[model samples]
Target: MNSLSPDSKEKTQKRVWEYPVPIVKGDNPEQVDAYLTGTIDEPSYYNELCHVLGTAEEGHSVTLHINTPGGIVDTALMVAEAIENSKASVTANIYGTVASAGTVIALACDDLVTSRHVSFMIHNYSGGMQGKGHEMKARQKYTDAHLSSVFNYYYGGFLTEEEMERVIEGSDIWIGAEEVAKRWQDKLKKAEGSDNG
Candidate 1:
């Protein structure tokens, strides 16, 4: 039933990998699929995504399925960077409850799609420190400044300046699917235009 000659170019087969599962490395750069489901708190989760995406070929199509309540800001940032740097074209299929640091990973993809009923949330980072009075105060200042930059880097355009300030002030913002689409329309258009060109 095969018509192609032996010298013909081989087509890459798409592979779907469900998250929270062990990563299976693929030999071909053109065939890579990675998924992210559940909390994004673990280093292993970061490693899994990178394992699949690291060798991706330019122009390869990759989709990352995301369903999570979010976790670990540092972990999410690392994952997002990997997604953004991949040579392949990556799309994030987000559904269920995406909250906290999960938004970072979802937004890093070259394209993003969300389910109709999906809920999105973002909030300020939280941490506690125990040390000498001066040390604790210094740590607090450093953490606040660092995390504020991270939030602005990812959510700057998607959220208004006022809303972003509130989030930095410890407010939790919840957004519906329609708003998500609306907020992201400009970015989507730009991506589309670039692809076409």
Candidate 2:
């Protein structure tokens, strides 16, 4: 896994100072222009997301629209932590397909909205490594620990222990909008009921 840090040149890109609602006209919503296309990585993506989340005015909730196939685990985890710690309500909209790291981001949001056809894939994090016997075993252990930490972190409040185990053991967990909506609604209802009671 690569370490995520802001590059000197990354500072030059135009910062998004306001929360943007996805629009069909004008600029492409999917592309983070400041970071450039095909430059998807931990540092740049994480910094850009932080800029967007941080720039949101205090006491105002922000909606984040995501359409990604996922990227680095560390970056995703950092973004999730930011969302969790934010005082403002963070709502995430899955505009397209969210896989791996992207799914992790959605899980962090206070409310998750998904398009009719939007898809979410959740699977254990994986990466290729170039090394010899002992080194390979060490890398595998590192990856396992990283994945375990992430599972524990995100599912701590959102999912039961058994549910978390199911997610981890499943080969590929793909959830559509309707299923996600029902689950979210149920969770929200439970919270509301608890508050009222």
Candidate 3:
């Protein structure tokens, strides 16, 4: 029960990693999916995302489709904060590579929807320091606190306390949707069980 030419062969069988939610197309009068592609480290990028948030009406579901290689860390944090404070229930739909600060901004959404093919990365905060030994040490301490906060922002949803510390100290941890999905599963189960009980 196979359909293949005598000389043809399949290199690899395709597999589905995550279930796709069918976003209703055609005439969608009730919701809007705002597109946000390219790098997130630019001032213009942050302005645009905020513009969208500002223009949105209350109770509207705004989903941000992010496809970027990420940009500036501070910019990403600003965007994330905007999403977190938005009146609209924000959903981040990441279908492409969202690394660096992009991952930070995306995770700020109330709901995160990662495509099966998406890949993400998280690294500790990095910046230059030029001062005396003690001054540099103080800067390092501040950087450490900032790095820990960002790491928690991305992974705090489900990671245990011990695991969180380990991950926060990591240099550059590359991951995919599986990590997010696993965490989301735990949260969903807890919510459902609590509701039933």
Candidate 4:
């Protein structure tokens, strides 16, 4: 049975599972309708999303409505993994500004829904550092290698190799909703096909 862990329970007061309409204190639900809005830096959003997924079952469906400027690569990755590992059929309804790590969560969904007016963006990760020159250099090298793997894995098909390279080189790639639709058409289709099968 799908249920929230004790720690997750203590962190969230909302219920994703409510059986039989007016849910009482002890009810179980199989589906989750969640949202990923605002900045991803907030731990509450992560907790809520995890609470929903914790109750997901094989035939369950989870809809995540996304609207964000994106934040924290680590948090985004954690959210992405949560969505990816869910047993439910996951769909992401992306709207508003979807940039940086926001795209990661969007792409992790099994299906996507967005308007032609939505704004989409992709760029390299950015951060600050301070230390000895050599130490900073070593850190930069390690960070680049690690993020390169992350970028390539997440955006391999969404962007051409040239575009991906440019992104790594600190270029910000922005596309309109129509362009995003055109670019991700094949990937979405493949995802749909796999879900159907």
Candidate 5:
């Protein structure tokens, strides 16, 4: 009887294990259910990200490629937390643009790599409220406080306390790849050193 060839065995082994790529590319323009404009707000997005991180293959890094203009703060935070808690190394690649909450998610990665033209924006989170005048003001205040806490929680890790304060004070803070690289080099370097140690 003829024995199974090496190539046949390799193909069989390859079929046994399937590695998943969980990057979410927003729906295309021609797609019927497409909502490509603005930020992504699908709850499934957060769930999928968590699942990918949780099921990542051992000894391999997970690269989250992002190009988003930012979206719901809570969802972004959830995704960021999933990335932060992942056992595998998480690297974020800023392909085109990452603004607002997107920037926060990028910072949660163990390593951030960006292309030359990549840009990110940092700004306070804002949401609309529908209520009576008095209730509206109270709601707004509550929202502002929550946003502030998020800013402090996320930026505190990547930026100096003073730097974070400055960014928070701005109406909108935009940083290019070069500026981001310069500002976070020290933190990234330290992380690398600690990982090696």
Candidate 6:
């Protein structure tokens, strides 16, 4: 469950830096800092985040600095679900390449910010197992259905169904910062305007 099929093997993270990032609110208030680097292979990542989110005060925020190439889809989804259910706000800063399940996890945040050179990618969730011919075929169908469910959950309004299909059916897509800004700014601006009005 922690690894994907060989077709989607990502290079191991050569390095990871974990540090506290303080965000000031109301003159001065402490905030939680969490980093999601490399792969999401273990359940601990999700558990620790759930603990942090649960302990943080309401209206307080936790910043999740995401710099991963993605990992176990189910594990990432667990963290994503925790974020969705948490009372504290979550901001996911995509600082590097956020791909596959990583992208889905990022979308669970209340706010998303992309670094100048960050790239985002969304494609099919791929997993495979060894079995007899019929078993393999059934597994493929199950994987496909599960992937579609994930896609819909994370990107229901991001693009048209047809466009989503094209990307899922085609090769991996690299979405640069400009495209992210274009797609996300309108929603942000709309919210800002409403707040001001």
Per-residue lDDT of 12-31 in model 5, one digit per residue for the tens? 55653332223432333111
Q: List per-candidate RMSD values in Å.
A: 6.9, 9.2, 12.0, 7.0, 9.2, 10.7
lDDT of 2 by residue, 51-93 (tens): 6565545564656677777777777777787777766677887
- Could you arrange the candidates by lDDT from highest to lowest? 4, 1, 6, 5, 3, 2
lDDT of the structure predicted as candidate 1: 0.77
* Per-residue lDDT of model 3, residues 1-197, tens digit only: 88766445332212111112112212554366655566665565457557666666678777878877776787877777778777788888887687777777776777788789887765655558799999999988887887787777566655556666666677566667877666656755655687799
**Better-scoring candidate (lDDT), 1 or 3:** 1
Against the true structure, candidate 1 reaches a TM-score of: 0.79
> In every candidate, how many clashes are there?
0, 0, 1, 0, 0, 0
State model 6's lDDT: 0.74
Off by over 4 Å in 3: 1-32, 131-134, 160-163, 187-197
| Colliding residue pairs in candidate 3 | 41-72
Total colliding residue pairs, candidate 1? 0
Q: Give me candidate 3's TM-score against the actual structure.
A: 0.69
| Worst lDDT 10-window in candidate 6 | 14-23
Q: Give the TM-score of candidate 4.
A: 0.77
lDDT of 6 by residue, 62-114 (tens): 88888888889888888888888888899988987988888888888888998
Query: Comparing candidate 3 with candidate 5, which one achieves the higher lDDT?
Result: 5
Positional deviation of residue 102's Cα in model 5 after best superposition, in angstroms: 0.6
Candidate 2: regions farther than 4 A off? 1-40, 55-57, 155-163, 187-197
Q: Which pairs of residues collide in candidate 6?
A: none
Model 6, position 150, has a per-residue lDDT of: 77
